[model samples]
Target: MRLGLHALGIGTGAEPAVIRAVAGAAERSGFATLWAGEHVVMVDESDSPYPYSDDGTIAVPADADWIDPMIGLAFAASATSRIGLATGVLLLPEHNPVIVAKQAGSLDKLSGGRFSIGIGIGWSREEFEALGIPFERRAARTADYVAAMRTIWRDDIASYTGEFTTFASIRVHPKPQQRRIPVLCGGNSDAALRRVAQWGDGWYGFNLRDVDDVAAKVATLRGLCEQVGRDPAELRLSVALREPRAPEAGRLAELGIDELVLVASPPQDPVAAAQWVTDLATDWQ
Candidate 1:
């Protein structure tokens, strides 16, 4: 199994130089990928429940400057050649599909096909409101958006007429190096699993605490793939480890996990945090 690191909770105080240095170090340390997280805007701390945490609170610095993941990945792409770039979970329904497809294609082309898109429907209702997207019908909208993006990626001239999106025949140039850029869906719901089987090249397991659960989910995902007439082996299994434990690695591998990404905790010093990730990558290997 390949070991990767998720650059989460890393302070936003670091300068561009620090970001590039850390990303390059990760690449040199033989990490398979460098992943990052995103949250466009945070609402005032209220009763809004943070989905990842039990108490419904975000653990990271709310005042810390936020950077766009696409732009950050682009910077990382320029800094490293081997390490793949990914958005731990890009909220698809929150953005325009056309723009996203174009940007993603550009990144893939520029990165020499070393980009994997991990997407989700998003959990924050406040974020949806802030983006001016309705919370209702988000799942359907996300599905159509993904379908439209695939059309844009695969066709020389793409046109789509959907309930939420419509476009005429337009040529999307500078096609990606990969015929089909890998789409990895993240979520643990049954609907999320179905989406993975229907549209994703892989399924990303989030909030997964144990390997037995991962194995069972993999079985379900495989069954869904078979039901959809897709080859089960074509579906990759990746899991996000909220807390890294060495013993869990073997169990994850046994559960057929291809990649394991450990979330980073905030460090007192940004440089120290980056170095910590570098050390973890080296030690994990």
Candidate 2:
């Protein structure tokens, strides 16, 4: 199994220099990938509850700097050669697929086929509403969006006439370096599993506390893959670890996890954040 790191890069803490330094250090340390999260706009803490956290609150500082993950990864890609660049979870339903496909293809082409897109349907109803996208029917929209993107990426002249999206035959320039840039689906819900089986190259899970539970989820995912006539082994299994619990790494590996993404706590300083990444890489490796 490959070990990697996921950084929130929250606050004014991660400047360009620190990002470059951390990317270089991670690539040098033999980490397989460097992942970052994205939130176009943070919701008002008082009105919107964070789904991932137990307390229904935004954990990071309200003033934390938020950069576009695709742009950040593209910048990091220019600084590192081998480490994979990925969105920890890009809220796909919020953005336009054609534009995303263009940007993602450009990044993958520039990165020499080292980019992977991990996407989710998003959980913030307020953000969706504010973006003029209906909070309901997000899943269906996401499915069509992904399908359209796949058509755009793999076909020469693509045209999608979906319920939500319509485009006449068009060609997206600068095709992805990889024939098909890997799309890894995020979330553990049944709909998410079905999405993985239907379209994703991998399944990305967050806050997986139990290895057995993960194993079961993988089993369920595989069953869905079988039902869809897709080979189970072709679907990569990736999980995010909140902290470095070395004792659990072995168990995770034994569970057939292809990648383990370690999430770092937000740092107060850019240099400190870079050093924290270096230290974690040194200690974990």
Candidate 3:
């Protein structure tokens, strides 16, 4: 299994030198990708329940910088040559699909096709309200937005008709250097698994703390793929390490996972962060 860093801390107000050091170290150490996560806004606490943590509320600092995922990954891309850059999961329902497709395609073109997109229908009602998007329809909207983006990427003259947005034949220039920019969908629910089978290039299971569930989810995804007539092996499987579950790497690989994306703590100094990553990888990878 390939190893990757789930996050780089430039957005935590870390200095540029630290960002470069972390990205450089990870790349030089043969890590496959550097991923950035997205969130447009956050509050002190909420009843909405942070699905990733043991406690419901997300533990992000009140002052934490929720930088734009693509821009952050673009910076990481500039710092390295070959390491893939990806969004661990960008909140797809919040943004305009045309604009996202342009940005992602531009980054992929600029990075020599080293960009991949991992996406999710966001869970925060407040964030949705803040953006004036209805939270309930986000999943359906996300499906539409992804379809639209794929159309933009795949065609020279792309036209789209969808529930939220539509346009006549128009081309978005500087298409991704790759024939298609890979999009990995994140979530473990039935709807999300179906979305991966239907719309995504891969499955990125979010907040997957239980190792047993990993095999179960993979089984479900493979069964769904067979039902859809898609070869299951063609789909990549990756998981974000929510906390410090250090011993499951081999088990996950045995279950047919393609990648393990480890999360790094937010620290202003890059040297420690780099070393911690190296230590974890040395023991696991």
Give me the overall lDDT of model 2: 0.82
Clashing pairs in 3: 50-56
lDDT score, residue 169, model 2?
88
lDDT per residue, candidate 3, 83-199, as tens digits? 989888899999999999999999999889999999999878888988998999898999999889989999999999999889789989889999588889988888889999987
Top TM-score prediction, candidate number: 3
TM-score of each: 0.91, 0.92, 0.93
lDDT of 2 by residue, 1-285 (tens): 787777645554256776776787788878898887777766556466665666767676656787788988998899899999888789998999999999999999999999999999888777787798887988899889888998899988999999889898899978999969899999877888999999888988876656766878888898899899998788878898544476777888877789888876536565676677778877765
- Global lDDT of each model? 0.79, 0.82, 0.82
- Rank order (by TM-score, best first): 3, 2, 1
**Maximum-lDDT candidate:** 3
Quality of model 3 by C-alpha lDDT: 0.82
**Considering lDDT, where higher is better, how would the candidates rank from best to worst?**
3, 2, 1
- RMSD values, in order shown: 2.1, 1.9, 1.8
Which pairs of residues have clashing backbones in candidate 1?
50-56
Q: What's the lDDT for residue 196 in model 3?
A: 94
Model 1 ranges off by over 4 Å: 8-10, 46-48, 265-274
- Report lDDT (Cα) of residue 276, candidate 1: 74
